[model samples]
Target: MSDRAAAFHALHRPGRPLLLPNAWDHASAAALAACGHSAIGTTSLGVAAASGKPDAAGATQDENRDLARRLRELPVLLTVDVEGGFSDDPAAVADYVAELAALGVVGVNLEDGRPDGSLAPTELAAAKIAAVKAAVPGLFVNARTDAWWLGVPEPRDEALRRARAYREAGADGLFVPGAPDDAVGLLAAQAGRPLNVLHRPGGPGLAELGRLGVARVSTGSLLFRAALGAALDVADAVRAGREADLPDVPAYGWVQELTERFRTDGHR
Candidate 1:
């Protein structure tokens, strides 16, 4: 494994979960790295929305690639969310991920949720995972099943079943987003790999998730949505002539300096 891939894999330790924040662009990623985030992921929704396209509909493959290229210059490990691998064909999915790996991405999140609100076949998902691992053995493949996210019947059973298949297919981690707090430990214990859960606000904190045997906790699109909401709230407050009640915002010069350093230094 490459050193970056090894470092990223080492971050997924049970009982000491890595809180991974997803960034939408170079500025957000550079800022996160500036704040000492050793690793950062790209949010598919954020990337698509920023490019005036839809998320999870295979509309942002090029956009994702471009973003990955930009983020490669940052001093942080990057894991991209390539929704459905941007294709159904296993070989195509593998090729796309291989390109990302070539650009220095250490990991990727490949989900089974389709754009039509239906889960892809379990075998197909497993095939994608297997293909990706075969193509880039060092790339950490976080195989995500949307049984819970899609509100399928008996999600726990479905998730576990899929988890077993993905594990057999060489998945490095199992991501069951929308799995409830009650079901986390069970999934973690039985998934046979590092368990990754999406972070839900007002839900169990990171410490609690670590105790539940979760190795990685991803913010997913939550940070992007929260950022949009905050921007709208600030705009509304300013329009209503009210002081924006917000945390300390980064100064304009600070952001410029952040990007400028990356531009000149190439990579930290």
Candidate 2:
């Protein structure tokens, strides 16, 4: 396996989950890297919105690749969120993932959520995972099922069934984004791979998640949304003659230094 891929794989320790923060652009990713995060994943929503496209609508294919190419230059491991692999054809999905692998992306989150708020057929989703694994054996594939999020009947059963199929198809991780706290352990016990749950505000904390046997906790779009909220809050505070409640705000030069470092440190 590629060293980066191996490193990323090793981070998924059950009961000692890796807290992965997702980023939208280079600056956001760089800031997280500078803060000592060992790895970062892209948020599909942030990437799509930044380019004025709808996420998971089969758009943003080029945008996702371009961002991955730039983010690969950061001093951290990179995993890309490729919604439905940007295509329904398994071969096409594998091709996209292979291109990403060649660009130094060590991991990918491929979901089965359709644009109409429905889960893709289990067989089709599993086939895509199999094709991606076949094409890029070293890349860590995190197969996500949106059963819980889409309000499917017997969401846990649906999620577990898909998770098993994905695991058999060689997925390295299983992600159930909207899984509830009570169901975490049951899912983790049967996922047969790393269990990745999306972290939410007022939900189970990282420590609590870790205790529930989750191997990964992804801040899927949460960080990007929080950043947006902070920006607007600061702007509103300035207009209202009130001090912003923001904390850990980086200075201009510190931000500028990141780009310089990426350039001079052989990112290109």
Candidate 3:
């Protein structure tokens, strides 16, 4: 395996889940990397919304690749979220994965959810996984099932079934966003791979998730949403003539230094 891919794989430790905080753009990614995260993921929703495009509607392929190329310049492991691989064609998806792999992306999050709020047939999803794995053997393909997120009947069972098929298809990880904390352990036990769960603010915390056998916990657009919420809250606070309750906001100089470092050392 490639050294970067190996590093990313090593981060997914069962019972000691890696906290993958997803970023939207270069500044967000650079800020997260500056805070010392070993690995960083791009949120597809963030990318789409930033560009005024709909995510998972096959509108962000260029955005995904562009972000991947930029994020790869950061001094950290990087993963790009390629929603449904941007095409139904397995070979096309594999080619996209190859492009990302060439840009030094260590991982990818490929979902089986269609923009129409339905699940792709299991066979097709599996084929995409297999193609990606064959094309970029070193890239960690986190196969995502939206059964639970899409409110599919018997979501748990469906997720598990798809997980099994994806595992056999060479998925390196399994992601079930919106999976209930209660069912998380069951999925983790049966998936036969590292289970990645989206972190809900009031749901099981990281420590609890680790005990449940989750190997990866992704912020999954939460940070981007939180940032937006924070901005709105501050705007409202200012309108109401109340001080914005901001905490842990980094200094302007620090962010400037990060941008400068990127400009100077990003080439390395």
Candidate 4:
């Protein structure tokens, strides 16, 4: 198997679905890697915000590529969120995917929802998937469907239709961030490809997710938002002369240890 394909499988540990954390920058991705994560993902929201662009709007294509180029040197495997493939033009989308693969990224998440909160045509998305695969045959495409986000009947039938189309178009797997747990089996069975679901708060944990046949679990923007919120809370608490409620926070020496580890490996 290819290195990129192996990376994706390395993420899925049988009973344990890949608890993929989405990082915004090198430090965040490195911090997670230091904590023993085998792979990392980039959040579209974080990427867009970092580049001063709107998320899911075909914005920040260059920024995303730049981030991937930087993260390619890191120890962990990287997957990128290319919001709607960064353009409506299939050729442009394929070019973007090709760049990402060249940067050593193994996987990508391409959504089907437009910036206007409407769903793109299934055929359009299928074409995007095909174009990307043609541009980079070994790239793992996690075709994302946002039917639930667009406020429809959740479009199980439509979702299945799109899922099949993407699979035929060479998508390696499928991601439905807002997929309901009750219908998880149905989705997985129909997908033919592995079903990837977002890790929802107070929802099914990793074990429960595996039982539902979820092959991958993505912590979309939750980690980034939580980390940002924690930093702000601690700063605000200090201003109020109060102690922060941060979890067993890493110490200065422990953080230096990460740099040391990388430095020893010549990544310094």
Best by TM-score: 1
TM-score of each candidate structure, all chains considered together: 0.97, 0.96, 0.97, 0.92
Candidate 1 vs 4: which has more TM-score: 1
Per-residue lDDT of model 1, residues 152-186, tens digit only? 99999999999999999999999999999999999
Q: What is the Cα-based lDDT of residue 173 in candidate 1? A: 97
| Clashing residue pairs for model 2 | none
* Candidate 4: residue 130 Cα off by (Å): 0.7
Predictions in order: lDDT = 0.94, 0.92, 0.92, 0.84
Measured over all alpha carbons after superposition, the RMSD of each candidate to the real structure, in angstroms, is 1.5, 1.5, 1.5, 2.3
Evaluate residue 223 in candidate 1 and report its C-alpha lDDT on the 0 to 100 scale: 84
Q: Supply the global lDDT for candidate 2.
A: 0.92
Model 3, global lDDT:
0.92
Scored by lDDT, model 4 comes in at 0.84
Question: Which residue window of length 10 is worst by lDDT in model 3?
Answer: 259-268
What tens-digit string does per-residue lDDT give for candidate 3 at 1-268?
A: 9888999999999899999999999899999988899899999999999999987798999998888877766899999899999899999999998998999899999999998999999999999999999998989999999998899999998999999999999999999998887899999889999999998988889999999999999998999999999999999999999999986888999988888877634353
Indicate whether candidate 1 or candidate 2 has the larger lDDT. 1
Residue 182 CA error for candidate 2 (Å)? 0.4
Candidate 4 per-residue C-alpha lDDT over 133-177 given as tens digits, one digit per residue, 9 for 90 to 100: 888877788899998777766478878888988899888888987
